[model samples]
Target: MHVLCTAGHVDHGKSTLVRALTGMEPDRYAEEHRRGMTLDLGFAWTTLPGPGAVAFVDVPGHERFVSTMLAGAGPVPAALFVVAADEGWMPQSAEHADALAAAGLRHGLLVISRADLLDPELARDDARAELAARGLGSWPAVAVSGRTGEGLDALRTAIAELVAGLPAPDPDAAVRMWVDRAFTVRGSGTVVTGTLGTGTVHRGQELELDGAGGRIAVTVRAVQELGEPVETATGVARVALNLRGLPREKVRRGDALLDPHAWPSVVEADVRLHGIGGPAQVPDSPVGLTLHAGSAAVPVRVRPLGDDVVRLRPDRPLPLRIGDRAVLRDPGAHRVVAGLTVLDPQPPALRRRGAARRRAGTLAAASGVPDAAGELSRRGAVRTGDLVRWGVPGPEVAALAARVPTAAGWLLDPTRATEAAEALDRAVAAHDAADPLDPGIPLAEARRAAGLPDVALVAVALDRAGDGAPGGPVVRDGRVVRAGDDGPPAAVLDAARQLHADLTAAPFAAPDADRLAALGLGPRELAALERAGELLRLTPDVALLPDAPDRAVEVLRGLGPEFTLSAARQALGTSRRVAVPLLELLGRRGRTLRTPEGTHRLR
Candidate 1:
């Protein structure tokens, strides 16, 4: 199904034409029926010959309801612009035309209504010229009379051709249905109607309602399309959703029902602006304005960044994305201010002097299109989900794997990755130079040294450093180390050799604190020797050869199975401090057994 909105001046026969085409009255309210003019948005549908089903959102053409007209036209893809034969064009006609053009409506048809009252050719030519001035001259034109049904068949044929030529919407796109109407039924709790531009809505599906109240969780109790209950409703169709959560009054017209986590709620965005009449039509100061996108009309503060670009700070966070188009209006003048194409939904803060001017220069090159490489490079790094929220479609995000290096759900820029790798190299080199005996820096410390936000990025930088490079960084035992760094420093190894020579001469004579101090064997150096299997530290103060315990066992065996501490110390030529702990270590290792009298027995 295709949905199209009506645009024209008041009393231009927009609703009358919709009623005649669909065989149903579009004016639902009693006041509208009596007044013979649309006061609010109305709905009607019909099946064209080749297009199957088409829906018309009959919007009011009155000047007072201009916001109402924008609300209807924002979500619909095509338009049915009406012009009466007797009245060629009017003030409301120009405003509505500006609205349709500001909305970026590409497919539409010009209908000259009440053709029986005068020659429709004159009205058609004037309408065409007016549309041509607004850059909409290619649309097809038809003459029809709602009262006499003149040229109704040709009008249907023109609509059928227009609907058939529209670009197909992605059924798998993320769901973001802008609510146009909301109410409560006696049986059902709440119901909201919208035009589902893409994606599908099914029964029991969960969606988020984003608006001034912030985002609230909502569930789909049921789905209906064209006044009939359905299991699912696909996009480009008018749908009424039976919601499970929130009261009818809470769900307002500007709220949106969206796929959870699929959109970013932004309070400020940078946009490329296009004025309706000319550059002068857009305000240049930070003046208060209203921004209308989809079914939302929000008050905003504007800051001009360039001649054709501006920054908007909305009163409330909006679920907007890159490449999304919206209309800016001045409520005081009740006029269309400008059209905007979003460039960045999440922009950096302009805190430094001349930042806004520099930002203007940066935004001047933007095409208002979502490019994965460009976005990642601009931010240095970002989460993959953020790209989706910024309006790069899921397929483009998936394609990032081939374009950049991703780690821990983040897409990294190539230059940023290279800089991180260089930082890691500098950190390792600085650490090694400061302490030659230190093996490497801890992973967390390395992450901080590299100025990375996440610890997981440490390994990524190490990998990017290229381990095969000479003396490149590598991870070892939770520490980032230089490649080919296997053992202790050369100075520590030389000290270990001297300690080994001393213990080898008098097997069990452990080194004293004074002797170890002379050899420069500190705790770290001693521990390094212990790791290399060259020394065994009985305690912080006692150190001996690695095989001292075995040699002591053999010596004790020579003195028979049982021996006292004094006897063992005399036999091993060591002090009581070394004898006591060494015996405990032997007993713990099952090499010797201790008696109740504090004697030692070889196992």
Candidate 2:
């Protein structure tokens, strides 16, 4: 099915043209028919001399209803730009034209309505010239009169030709449908009417209300194209989806229904502003504007980069993919200032202008090549949409992705992959230099030291650095260690000797902190020694020698079951601070089980 929307000045006969072509009234409400003006979106279906159906979204043209017009036009890729023969061009016509251009609608036919009321030749010439001025050149124009039905056949033929030539809609990609009109059906529950961009809406598929963050499990109770029930609707077709598990109030106009996993609700984007006419000498500062994308218009604040680029921050989170074109219009002036294509929607950092530029440069370079994997090796993961914004065609972008390298399903540039591995290696070496006896740097601490972006990348880096070598153990649980460096520190070795001597002399007691301090071991130094796997500081004061055999057996033999905390403190010959940790360590080691009641025997 093919869907097209109508746009023109107020009362320019857009609705009349739709009614004339479809032989159905586009005005749904009695108030609209009586007032002779369309207040809301109207739908009509007409069968052309073709294989599929053509759906028409008759949109309101009044200046006040511009937002409504946007909602209707947002999803449709084709349009019927209507013009009244007598009036030629009006202000609303220009506004609607701008809206269509902003939304990136390029396929359309210019319909000169009320042709019978004016001199046919003059009306045709003037309409042609007027549309031409708006950059709509030589588009098949049909002069039709709703009163007389003159030229209706030609209009139908023109529409049929336009629809037939449209590129086949992609229904298997991510789902995105802009809601032009949403309401409740008596028996159908919540009905949302719009054009589906990509992906099919099956009878029982799950769809997420994107802007609202609401989930709706819909059984395609019915599908309507041009007012008649259809089995399925593809991209570029007007559709009214009867959704289950949702109410009318929940699905509003301008909301989108998309694939939950495929579509991200929040996106960070790098935008290049093309001044409407030419380059503008604009200052580098943040400015608020209205962003029009798909069927949604949102308030966004743009942080400018020099004179031409800006980082756009949408007020409300929006579902956008890489390469989606968005119009940035000055909200106060109500004029479109520029158009932007989304680069990195869901960026890691929004404030770092330098990082954004680096990413953008990488995206730009990757976009220019045929092999994205090769490019990613030099750069990083490029947002699929960003490549499109950089002027790489969709098919080419998809082709390039075949070469993209991935680790555990996450795409990684070869350079970044290499950098991550080197960073991890440097971190391990640094830790070993600082504390030779330490087992390794904690994984979190290693990542921080390496300045890696995420833990997943860090893991990949460590795994690569290890290279599955039997002798090279690059990482241990939460800690990274070099193979040869797991040796005891001098301080830990000295403490270990003292601990063993004390245990030998007083088998039932552990040494106090003063004794460990006397041997030149502090808590910070002890922690470092423990991380080095040199000495186990089982208790604050009770230091266990690394060579101690199953130390838990010694603890249980010495303390026995039902040992009191005071007795353990005295046995350790230290304060509560030292004895508590000692008891806890013994419990952990299964030497003695410490319960809430007190210590117990492991047996």
Q: Which 10-residue span in candidate 1 carries the lowest summed lDDT? A: 276-285
Evaluated with TM-score, which candidate comes out highest?
A: 1
TM-score for each candidate, following the candidate numbering: 0.82, 0.78
**Best candidate, lDDT-wise?**
1
- Candidate 1 structure quality by residue, lDDT tens digits, 1-603: 999998895862777788889998888899987777788889999988889999999999988899999998999999999998988888888889888888788789999999989999999999999887777889999999988999899999999999989999989889999999999888898999999999999999999999888999989999999999999999989999999967887888988999999999998999998766456344855766789999999989988777777889998999999999999988788788888899999988889988888888887778889987788877777888889888897788899856777789887777777788788888888887887667678989988887676777777756765744757887777888887766687788888889888888987777788888999998888876775576889987688888888888888887787899899999988889888999999999999888898778888
Model 2 scores a TM of: 0.78
Model 1 segments more than 4 A misplaced: 34-36, 277-282, 357-365, 431-453, 465-467, 484-603
Clashes of each: 0, 15
Each candidate's lDDT (Cα)? 0.86, 0.67
Candidate 2 whole-model C-alpha lDDT, 0 to 1? 0.67
- The sequence of per-residue lDDT tens digits that candidate 2 reaches over residues 3-62 is 888888477277877877787888889888787788988888877787357778888988
